[model samples]
Target: MADSVPKASLYYYPPSIWCAAVLLCLEEKGYSEEEIDKKVVDLSKGENYALSFLRLNPKATVPTLVAPLEKTLSAEVESRFKALTETKTIIEFLDKSRSAFSRTNTTSSAPAPALAPATIAFTTVSNSIIDLLHSDEAHPGAARWYNARDEATLAKICPSLQAFFAAKRDAIAASLAESEKGAIQASAKTKKFWEDKSTAASEFAQLFGDGEKPESELSPEAKAKREEYFNTAKLVWETNLRNVLTRLSKEMIGPHALGDQLSLADLHLGAWLARLVTLAGGDISDKGDVAIGKLEKHIGNGFALPKDFQWTPARRDDTSEVKPVVQSKLAAFWDAVRERPSWKKVYANGLH
Candidate 1:
């Protein structure tokens, strides 16, 4: 009889940064699409907040992996599963589960590339970099909060953000209505879940949605609150993200974050940087300097590479004094990561 191995299901949204990280990890580890069931949760429609999905992940975040329990591996017991909700946990599971000696390596003939650092020192550096990238201040999603600098940009961005929140709010309202009308009443727990989601959505819509008046015509209090939100976001980006980038540049050894070899840190950094690049209006195809320039423009004047960092000097003329060229190890890391097959495949649709 054919083996009755239970397959895992990956719940993800294509445009999510951490989802992209998990997807990249799967590709890098040689997990074929057929090996795992891939389910897309539409965040725009608030599918993540549905009672069914929330049962699997109370936080309603992706990418979540539902893996078969070890006891079920023998095929004697009915299949039991567990959910992995965090990106770091998911990546570690994928790496260790598919290693050369792992029984789960049945799908691939070649040994999976070792992504974890082999040495203690390299491992320390790798973990630290990964933590930095995942920090709240460096989160790529926050890029949208402060990306618009002037009136023209806000005019374009505000409406889109408003629309996004409006859709989510409407979706949550629909779900709540449906539950209320169901023949079998939702359990108290389920009812509370829907109510909580509905309240949160309404609040977000109020804060982010455009009302009858355009933003410019809004009351002074309203305008000030909105301005303060964006200002705080910008401050967080300037202080935290700049520090994160500077640390990455200084810690990087070369082509990758740790050195020549790709480590777990590279996977997290690659996905995070790609999202930042796209949010900053830079294309995945942009050269290192071009991408860096776009990010600097978005971040304003305070963002700069470390002053003491070495760079090849350029001279305007033979008699002219040399000027340090704009370059960064962070950018070099980006250039290297974008060239990987896994990156190309995961981002084939577009950077998210």
Candidate 2:
């Protein structure tokens, strides 16, 4: 029995942003890292494609959840896995079906009032984050505003943002080779994703074909494409970045994701932002630096704070590090969320 997996458990990888969200949610529900059985799936070696993992989530994505197999389950629900895929659905499941308020949560309730049960605010903030993801992805041909310029533009920035994509691409390539060595066919999407990422990486490499060479060295067609790609990327990011940030800021209702109550909403938002901003972020210019959408620029350079901004002292357990970025209500909301005890636990030990 000691060697057997828990009847219920969370399987995830540390690098996955969504996993971080779920971990925080579990903590908020009064489940400690030690309390819930957790399985760390190593996607780097393609463990996610293993048949066993595929049984849990066909998509092969991280943060896959496994419900406790129990005899008490209703006949209709018993047959289903309750296996949750993607951060949004996983968070929703935890909030609706498994909440700290509904569970035996003595840990998180005293310091702060137990968060309001998940509400429409969860859907609202979740959707906003997805919108932000679309803007961030900007993948060629997939974006709605399909134009060659945007296509080329995203390609050009791909090189500048190589750190963001290269790690996953390389891992998939390696995983494919390993699968062949082990005589395992791997999962359905495993090979396909590797091929797609390989092509994308090669294209990004080509964009940076001549880091030291002058633009004159390229053919006229190549030069025009490069020029349009990079210039358009710069223009689009610069033009809308501030507006997008302000829009998200205004949408936050309180100190956390939806309102003052620390709900699963904050978990998803904090986990995603922390991964993009604090962990993977390297170059100050890259999108990984969640700071791009933050309000630090407005406050530091002698700019006035937003009139509606709530200026709480940034000093709280782990929140002191988050400091105050009082450019908008949204900024302050996140600032508060980061300091949350559940978030701190997720940060300290949930991953890896």
Candidate 3:
């Protein structure tokens, strides 16, 4: 009978924090990535292993797992996932099957959006800290402190959030080449794509803080080649941010509040919020911006975070730390280089 159980395969994106959240849950459930592919999704040429795996799971989203082993035992085994989607539901199902119904309040009116506060908070703060640290312009004190975090602690106890984002940024960079090429081929469409993306970013800025044009709006040729890809990416980021904030708001004021156990929502929203702030020239405070103020209050009161949520304690002496040079040019070049297939080849070959 044990042989009848299915062998599980997880289909997921390396960089997705939500996927990472699901991964953590799976890890707690004793699943291993050795059981799952570590490949990043290839978005160019419309290729994604995760998408292909969705032949069974039509959702086509990351963090999906399939139980192929069960197919050999029974016809239904092929239909049922080894267990993906709904961490709490899966836990409850397993418990109920064993007559271990502990009368837990497993179900709630809140949408079972996988990116809950705990998941989001860890992903967001960690990513924000990492990104800031990696940036050349990051405050020397901040960078030193972040770098000083024990490597083992970050690897083991930091909850695997870094792995998720690293995988995502790499995947996005890899996929952009195809997206850029496609955009370049369609001049008018590409212009629309960039304009649309810029407009979305502008709106996000306006909503959060500022609506001024980014100084680096694309050039005519580059805009034509890259706008659509950025536009689509911007839209995805926008939706994710909104979803996180809306859920958080509902949780704060409504009956569905995130009681005690904060989730991925906090991290997801926080990261994007930080991004929006960064793009808008670090003006997180809204002047006469009622909506922004309300949102800030909601974030503050809802999460019960420290007043210094954004600050990290310094780990190095002020005099000993050297200010890091901003890598804007190098970072831009790296960003462009990462999109090339050769980059992946080099990575695979351990050449870089």
Candidate 4:
């Protein structure tokens, strides 16, 4: 029998924001679950560190897509696979690969809507917005990781974070034990990989997980390191994220990132904003001032509306005037994307 063609697979974690972005794009592109395999790499258990997965994605990150190259997408030829390790790249690949006109997409009854912008101006805007959302300074995922603003919030998050660290430590220890058995132990590279991971995980657990000490109980060195981490987290939300939101409000062309048509920018922005909302302890269902208030409390800054923006006036009896409403541009964008079936499906369980 001839060698079987390799099927495409996505290695992802459920609560990952970037994974959610790719998942949302996949849904929007009209892909069924059967078309592509979904493989969950459990981050809590350090499954990403497994040698098999590491061979695919050296970075040990989720949302990795293993797909056959276009030239190799034939049964007659041996298939060559490539790992798309970045979320934005994976989304773009998914968007471009599934159009109705593509030879591989014969079953689609209608054309998949182009997610990439059609014009240069829109393309520039879309790329810029996507870059900003994924920037290190404005990273919502890191912000969520270091989110413990007050005693009340710290208490709420510590238990889960501790559990996560404990699982990671245990998993790494198991891997180390397995690495020491048999001929595999002779490979220095493999041995170092587990040892390096073990050391890093232990350091992290000490600082943020199992070895976390009370403020007064911490050594001066440990105290300073912890304080620096917390301060950096605070700075990210107060400065970088706050500024990013301001830029989004001004740059957005209303309803969507670039007018009426949904583009790649919308996919990234929607996922990024959803994460920010969740980090603020707010729900995606939150609207207007309620949403703003929750974000403000979390970021420790006022979310300013445009200067010329007017609030809807209060309703009066026997009048045709609509009831007063409060909303910002970001809130409008959130509301617009939240209505999509793609968004609903990705977040069916809850906002990550």
Candidate 5:
């Protein structure tokens, strides 16, 4: 009976935190990647606005779920294929549509959304964090230093959010090669494709915008503005992130976003925190070095953390030592998340 259930094809971009959350949820719900296709949308080049994509989602947001129409005995439900938008809506669909209920006897049973409290918490806190992370003010700093998050655990945790876009870079290289071969007809498409893969760094400068360029390379004027904007972004995100951590830890009285069990809230918050960790420019090894012997003995998971200098904790605080405290708290939560095997699988196999 379970074999007959419909699966969704998730259309997403590697860098989207919301897409990361949806993926975690999909895995938690026992949907395998084979059952659900992971389609990467190249947003850096304006592919999200591509007319072909617009047909499925006009707004061109990431993490869109497309599923076959379910056959129901009721006239109320539509019979067309479902193209769901938004992480929240898609998650709700995944939760409720687990098994088919006979439409004839629909009134005999009550169908309720699962995890009301967790959903409410996710909507309130995690949603805010995601927005603050993606706000125009924050994207620049994140895109500027996307590579700093390279850690064994992170490489294990967020490949879906990294490799998908890495593939886009490869795609662009191939397209550029095609153009070099004098494919004039494909020139316009390649132009838009390149545009979709670029970040603010590329938009402002003629650079590939891969976050490989050092801040020293930017023009004086651009460098000053970048520093100014990043500082503001740091303050804004730090304030919100600390608030969420407090609520999850001190107020909730458990390791997760709501309580002992993981929920949608954790998925949302974890994805954002993972990004913030990368932007911090330090890895789990930095903290491990402080207690590496003790941590290795205690972890029991047998996964050796990489010892690298790619990650260096960025200073977001100018007046206080609070950043470490917050980072510590966040790491504690990240550790709990890593303990979950399903959570670990999403980041496995080169992010599949």
Candidate 6:
């Protein structure tokens, strides 16, 4: 038997999106970086076997986090970790935990929580968007709405979203500007005030993930540096999303899909495209946004949803017609992405 000491086992493929999403969730849950990284495995080339994975988890999917087996271990430790570590389970665990972590975490001392979990929330939202868009009951109006969400439509929507963020950003800037004006005469509280403000600004920086630039897009040396950075973020972000999405797409859209209800997959796709464009710092051209525009339309128009598709938004105030809890989280995550400077850059470019 293999020794399970000093580490828990995580069977994962580096390129698997679910694996990455799970990893991000773990990080959000206040797990140490060392602990989180230790469990990640890159099984991209068929290294994980069905039996081996089944021994750990019957589901046998990538991103399985298995605790180290030990003789005479207390039931509590075993039960807690075991009960809480699956992808969706872990995601929920982190959602609550990250808030707690943010309250007490002295490691960063930043205004916002470390963004390791933003990616986690991103995956969750994307999954929801994907599920909603594909369901049969998807509102007919959504199709046309999505079609309209094209670059041209975004030219309109982007302005609205941008105006919202710009005002917020400007408020922060003005407050900071006031502080700078009194920097020399600043008192202890004033100094603390400025420090707090600086931390808040950096939160936006931490939340945005920028991968390396392509060699084709840059000169050799710059490309290499950008590539390295991109590789790190991409490996952790995109690669993980790919794994999760593949499983989800096949399971949901494929022939032998999961439960009758439409799920997180559709939301994931919409959120994903939204993030991609945000990351790229541009919106799709008026017509170009068509690729993902359909999804937004479906969401906006109220999907008809299949009879069996039962996950509805949990709240009465939510505009969505799907699972409320999932929708709420997704809405928050999308709000964050849209507010980022990267989003502005992308939206500006979309005008072209």
**TM value for model 1:** 0.87
**Model 5 segments beyond 4 Å from truth?**
1-7, 32-35, 43-46, 68-79, 99-202, 206-252, 282-329, 349-352
TM-score of each: 0.87, 0.62, 0.32, 0.87, 0.55, 0.32
Candidate 6's residue-wise lDDT over 140-226, tens digit each? 212211222222343343333334333434444554556578643434554454445445433322222111222365656545544
Clash number by candidate, in order? 0, 0, 20, 0, 12, 54
Order the numbered candidates by lDDT, best leading.
4, 1, 2, 5, 6, 3
Those runs of model 2 whose alpha carbons end farther than 4 Å from true positions after fitting are 1-6, 42-55, 69-82, 100-171, 174-182, 186-190, 205-236, 239-241, 275-307, 311-327, 348-352
Q: Residue 72 deviation, candidate 1, in Å? A: 1.8
Residues 1-352, candidate 4: write the lDDT tens digits: 1236456799999998899999889888887665678999999888987778878987788899998888886787788989999989999989988886554422345447889999999888888888888899778757876786544465467677767766777786876777767523425776576678777667666666523356777789877767776787678887888888888877878668897777898888888888888888888677645665687677775546553223454567665768544467676666678889999999998888
Q: Please write out the lDDT profile of model 3 over residues 148-198, one tens digit for every residue.
A: 122232223222333333343344343344456773232454334334433
Q: What lDDT would each prediction earn against the true structure?
A: 0.77, 0.53, 0.34, 0.77, 0.51, 0.37
Candidate 2 TM-score versus the reference: 0.62
Model 4 residue 200 lDDT score: 64
Candidate 1 worst ten-residue window by lDDT: 305-314
Error of 6 at 259 (Å): 27
Off by over 4 Å in 3: 1-4, 29-54, 57-60, 68-250, 253-257, 261-352
- True lDDT of residue 325, candidate 3: 30
lDDT of 1 by residue, 12-33 (tens): 9998899999988988888866
